[model samples]
Structures are given as structure tokens and as C-alpha cells.
Target: MNRWLVPALALALIAASAASLLAGTVWLRPQDVLAAIAHPSDDLPGLIVLQIRLPRVLLAMMIGGILGLSGAVLQGLLRNPLAEPGLLGVSAGASLGAVIAIYYGFSASFSLASPLFGLAGGFVTASVAFLLARGGGTLALILAGSAVTAIAAAGTEVALNLAPNPYAAYEIMNWLMGSLADRGWDHVRLAAPFIVAGGALLLATGPALDVLALGETQAESLGVAVGRMRLIALIGTALGVGAATAVAGAIGFVGLVAPHVVRPLVHHQPGRLLLPSALTGALIVVLADTATRVMRLGGPPINLGVLISLVGAPFFLWLVLHVRTRTA
Candidate 1:
């Protein structure tokens, strides 16, 4: 796709997001949303639209884009379309740290500390998986990822179960389910730098990813430093997925599905796919989040992660089928 198209699509998505943000639990027209943006605080609706919904939507988009790009990079590196931070235990690791911090009451002491710890946990798990897979092939990577993920997920469940405070369990449950209902600029401020930096790193690795698409020996013959590229890409994935999950919890399927949805827009060129994947991911998350806020079953809202899983599970099955056919 042309460079202009990405920006154009982003703009359109932003506009749609803005409209959806305005039409939240209480419906508001597009003109009302525009008026609110123009003169925020002039009315209750304006304030809610500009101060509350808008920020959350923007943050969701940024986080989703980061996850999408990170997924694309990981899939390219592993030569597996099913590879994602969530599958590789990166999200589980981050969730473990964040939940631990929250359960231990550290989050109450310092707001930034939760994410810092979460980042550490994410890196640790990713490192373990990488080491376990380093000398082996795709099978090793998958096995390592599954093992680490299982362990970390069990640890998270244990922590939640052992928490003294009842609220802690609920909090962990909420985080696990994922939601953008009450997020604000502070969440955005906390996550944006890491996401942007990680995104830059991912974008920088695109050329190396393109070479890796040609198979390992061919890529090495073409002068691509395979090991170095993998290291950088791993670090980038940790940064992007860690920071996003730290803020939003494990918002699943964006990374796995975004690239697949937008790959055709880029004509199946791995390098060109990144931007479109990011855009599509951003659009998906923001729209899905908006749907969560708007759609209710009598009282409580639906889980964001559940919504994504509903969509992602079938997509995953289809991907497996396609991959099997291709290999066969």
C-alpha cells in the first residue's frame, strides 16, 4: 500500500473512534462530539466526550497498534503466523508482575511501579522462552513458549487466589478480562512513550524481517545478521507488549489478527504489512472497546478480552487450517 493510504486510514479510524467515543453508554450525535472537542467543558456531554471517552479510545488505539506491529514482527521472526506475545508468554509474564504488585499493595504506593515490575516480568519470561528455543527450531520455540506461558499463568492464578484482600481478586479478574471504561490521560501518558519507542524499533527491523522471510540460510546468505535481528526484535516485542499489557492487561487477538487482516493491503510484502497491520489493529481495538461500552446485557458490560477471543478463536482455527494446507 502507498504511504498516503496508511495516514488516510488512520485519520478515518480516528474520526470513527471519536464518534463512537461520544456515543457511549449514553448516545450522542457526531455534532455533539465535535462541539465537545471544540469547546471541552462547555457542557456535561462535551466534558465526558473530551475528557473521558476520547482519551481512553486514543490509548486503546495506540496500544492495539503496538501489539499488532509486535505480533507481525514476532510471526516474521518465528516464521509462524500463530506467534504472538500472548502465545509466547510475554503478556502472561506482564500480567503476573502487575497482578503481583496489585495484590501486594505496591500499586497503591506508586503508580509507575506496577508497569515497571510488569516490564521486568515480561522480559524474564520472554528471555526464558528465547533461551529454551535458541538452539532449536520452530518446534522448540512453540514448546518453550507453551511451557513458560503455562507456568506464568498458573503463578498468576495462585497469586489471585492467595490475595488477602477480596478486592485484589476482583481487580485481578478485571484486569484479566480487560476494559477501557474508565481510562484517562494518565494511562495514555504512562504507556505512549514505550509503545512509540517499541513501534520505532519494530519499524526499523522491517528490512531484516523481509530478509528473514526468504528462509534462514537464504537470509544469512543475503547478509542479514539473523541472530542480531532476532535479538533486536525480541527486545522490541518485550517493550511493546510489556508496556501495552501493563496498562491494558492482556488484550488478546489484536496482535495475532491485525496483520492477517491487513496483509493483503500491503500485497503480502512482510515489510510493507507492518503499517497497515498497525492501523487495522488500532481500528479493531478502538471499535471493539467502544462496542463493549455501548453493548450491555441488562446491567454489567461484557469483557473486552472475551469479545476479542470470540473473534480470535475462529480466526486462529482458520489460520491453522491454512498453514497445514500450505505445508502439506
Candidate 2:
């Protein structure tokens, strides 16, 4: 692994985070941001920097870090370069839960109803997938996840189609687009614990993933508990990704892209790839969120998820072509 890779990613993430704090409707100078952080005041700049941007930046980091970490673990566990956290249906299930909350006006009654429902949905779907894939190998797990994802996606679509009012539909659509805008410390508080715990669980599996890359049979013969590792990966991914989706809505592609971007730098060692992938993911999200604030795309700014998808769609195409070329 390149010695400088992790440090480089860490430095980049720091820079992006700074940019996120600085770039907004009313841009703050470096000095202003520092002042706000050092001694928060009731002034507009202080409020903007401390209350608004700080929470958003922190949430972005947590979400991105978890997504990236989970992606690396999932890819390693499944032994598939194309694998990502969403392949297990957590994001879809979370979305369905949030949509259900919005559709039923549960969000109107309780601010956290959507996120809470989203968490429950993610856990349930992941549990179902695991149960279906029990005693089976990676292929069965993948198939089970695909099935759950389809079901959750269908539920989300049904809710959207049957929305009682256009306003509710608009709210649902907006949330699905995903954004860090208007997010306060409450969201950070809601998601922090889950993301942290989930991140720890995923990171712990790095060594096992490295061995499992050789083949499940070989890994078991080498005294690695493959089933236990799979369970850990699943639970970790579900918790982290689910909480992230619950708060931020259906942000995508970070998990899929972050691991691939850092794999070469880590010499393709799954264990070494985890931390750098997480740093890269945080950098990507911070940069993307910053871009959303500065860009003048007419009336309102671009949605965070939409902007990411725009970039990720092209990257996905390139990845497919690259994979085909290698195989060919």
C-alpha cells in the first residue's frame, strides 16, 4: 500500500470539510469561520457557521464514512468488486419506511417519525434477507437481498403513486432527492451513535475479509469464521447505511464509488482499503454538499443525491466498460 495514500485522503477530507463550512448562501471568510468555532455568538455569521454548517458538515462526514466503510467491507465479504451497501436492500427499505411515514402524515405529528420508521424498515428487510440466505453462500445472500430490495422499492413506488395530496407527494419527492440543507444538530444527534457503532463493527472485519478473499472454503480451512464475518458485515452495513438513509434520505453511489477509487492506492488489499475508502467518501460528500450550496441552478439549489447521481452514473458506465475490457 502507498504510505501516503491514507494521509492524502485525510488531508483532502479536512479541506473539503472546511469548504463545506465556508460555502453557503452567505459565504464566510476563513477568519469568520474560525471566530464562529472558537467563540460562537448570536451574529448571523456565527449562527450560519456554528449552528447550520457545522451540523451539516458533521453529518455529511458520518454518513459518508459509514457508507464508504460498509462498501469496502461488503465488497470484500462478497468477493465482488461491484458490491456496495445498497445491494443488501438497506437503503431501499429505509426509503420505504420514510416514505410511509410521510405518506401517512406521521412526520407531521412527530419530527423524528420518518427517521425512526426508516431505521425499523432497514432492520426488518435486512433481517429478512439474512433469514432467507441462512446456511447458503454469497450468491444466495445476494439473491435474497435483491428480492428484498425489489419488495421495498415496490412499496415505495406504491406509496408515491397513492399519495393523498400533491403537497405530500412533493415532500416525499424532495426527501428522496436527499440534501443536507436545513439539517441541524438534531439530525447529527440522531444518527451519530448508530453510525459510530456500525463503523466499528465493519472495521473489525477487515482481517477476516482479507482471508475470505482467498475463497470461503479456504478461509474456513484457515480458521476464519466466514458465517460470523458475514453476519457482522450485514449488521454493520444495515445499521450504518440505514441510519444514514433515514436522516439524509436516499443518498447513493458513495459506497459504490469510494471503495473502487481507493482500492488501487491500497494495493487492492481489502483490509488496508477500509480507512482510505472512508476518508475518500467523506471528501466526496463534503465536496458535493459544498457544490450544492454554491451552484446557481435557477430557483433552488441542486439536491445532494441528484448531483451525486449525475456524477456517479457516468462513473458507473466507465466502470462497466473497464470491467468488460478486463474480462475480454
Candidate 3:
């Protein structure tokens, strides 16, 4: 099954990427896409395909992969099926930073300021959550995360509340709604390095996580540094999700859904679920963003975050019901 499933997911990613390039407001042909990539120029088709949509598509894929992987890593570390970066306060922390930047008009002055500050905020919140969760069991971690999430969320609301004017307030509010509109290569360049570093750290934790699944006492018996391993995962999730949220503004649920989708395919091993979860996440965001561009027949373009929330809320409800039924 690995032979077929991995390749199939790869093909799906590739196909979805191709479809993203071809299906847009202008609807470029296959050759048009190739040409735009080869020679980006001032022409309408070249400028539209190369300058606008391509970067947005790549951004969606990258952000999706990062969020998906971060969610999988956190779930593994915490041993909680409902765990995700958002629920852990990482995404909310990042959103708070970006919102603060916008509130002060710092985002307009500096291209990289929002994301960098977002990273700082995520680390701070995750650090606090870690400190609170230390020495406690799984329940402690979740409760601590919940507490931090509420705090960070309240902070974000404060930032929004203090917006200088209604327009500024609308911008701040809309940023939380999350759109990929008009994103360029600059956003990609700014976000790519942090995601790469964070993803590397996350990828390294898989073995330790697998050991961790056996319980802390058993993990220590197997020579795993349980404390250090959790630290790495905590930091990695903060970094990756912060960077993604900095650019994408709190696109939700990709990570939570992606891991659940791939877990059964990987036979329920958390370690093996990581890479496939990333792939599934890339597929989801690309397709969702694509629909946003093409399916705006008469209405305004759909925000990517809105699309995910529309699907995710229902899916999450169903998952909760299913899990409760099984436990009952």
C-alpha cells in the first residue's frame, strides 16, 4: 500500500498544482503556464499567471504543508487527537503579533516585520504553555494550552479594539479572516526560511515521538530525552505555524484534518503519518484556493480561511461525535 498511496498522493499534489496554474480568473492554458514560468514579462497573461496566481498557489501549498506537519507533530507530542496548533495557542499567538503590527502600521513600513514579530509572539506563548504544562500529564498540557489560547485570543481582540479608525479596524478584522489575495514572491521568500528550519526540527522528532507514545517512563527506559524531545516539538510547532500564520493570517484546520486523514493510511503510526499528512495538507489548500479563484461567478472571491472553516467545523463535529460514540 505504501507503494501505491505515496505515489498517488504525489500525483495528486502535482495534478492539483497543475490545475491551480491552469484554473484561475483568466484561465491560462497549459502552454501559457509554461511560458509564464519560462519568461515572465509585462504581457497580461505572463504577468497574471507568473506574477500573481503562481506565487499564491505555491504559498498555499507551503503554508498548508507547514501547518499540516506542525499539527501532526503536536498531536504526536501531546498524545491528543483533538490537538492542533490553533488549539495550542501557537496560531493565535502568531495572529496576535501580525495584528499588533498592523495596528501600529508597522506592517506597511517593513516587509518582514509582521512575520518576524509573529514568530516572537508564538514562541512566547508556547513557552508559557510549556512552563505551565511541565510535570503534568497529557491533561495538563491540554489545559495549559487552552488557557494560553484564551489569553492570546483576548490579546488579539484588544489589538482589534484599539484600531485607529473603522477602516483600520476593518483591515485588522479582515486579516483574521485570512486571504491569499495578491500575495507575491516576496511573501514566499520571507516565510520560506523559517518554515524550512522549523519543518526540519519537526521532522527530526518523529522517532522520539514514536517512543513517547509508549509513555514517559517507557520512553526514558529506551534512552529518549523525553523533556528535550517535547521542547523541540514545542519550538518547532511554534516556528512553523507562526511563519505560516504571519503570511496567511490564521488559515485554520489544515493541520488537524490532514493528520487525521493520513493516520489511517499510515496504519495509525504517528511517526509514519508525518510526511503523508504534509502531502495531504498541500493537496487540500491548493484545491481550496483554486476553487476560490474559479468559482467566484458573481460574488466576491472567497477567502481561503472561510473555505476551510466551512468544511472543518462540520468535519470536527462529526469526528467528535464518532469518537464519543466509540468511547461510550
The TM-scores of all predictions, comma-separated, are: 0.88, 0.96, 0.92
> Which candidate do you rate higher for lDDT, 2 or 3?
2
Candidate 1 residue runs with Cα over 4 Å from true position: 1-8, 108-113, 127-144, 315-328
Pick the winner on TM-score between candidates 1 and 3.
3
lDDT of 3 by residue, 1-328 (tens): 8657778988999999988988876888899888878987788888888788888888988888988888898888878877787866888888888888888988889866777777788878888988999987656767887899899899989887877889878878778888788788988887888888888999898888888788788989999887787778777777788788888888988888889877867877888888888888889999998988887757777788999889888987887787578669
Q: What lDDT score belongs to each candidate, Candidate 1 first?
A: 0.81, 0.90, 0.83
Candidate ordering by lDDT (highest first): 2, 3, 1
The local distance difference test score of model 1 is 0.81
lDDT of each residue in 84-166, candidate 2, tens digit only: 88999999999999999999999999988888999999989999999999999888999999999999999998988999999
Candidates 1 and 3, the one with greater lDDT? 3
lDDT of the structure predicted as candidate 3? 0.83
Where is model 2 poorest over a 10-residue stretch in terms of lDDT? 318-327
Best by lDDT: 2
Clashing residue pairs in all predictions, respectively, total 0, 0, 0
Best by TM-score: 2
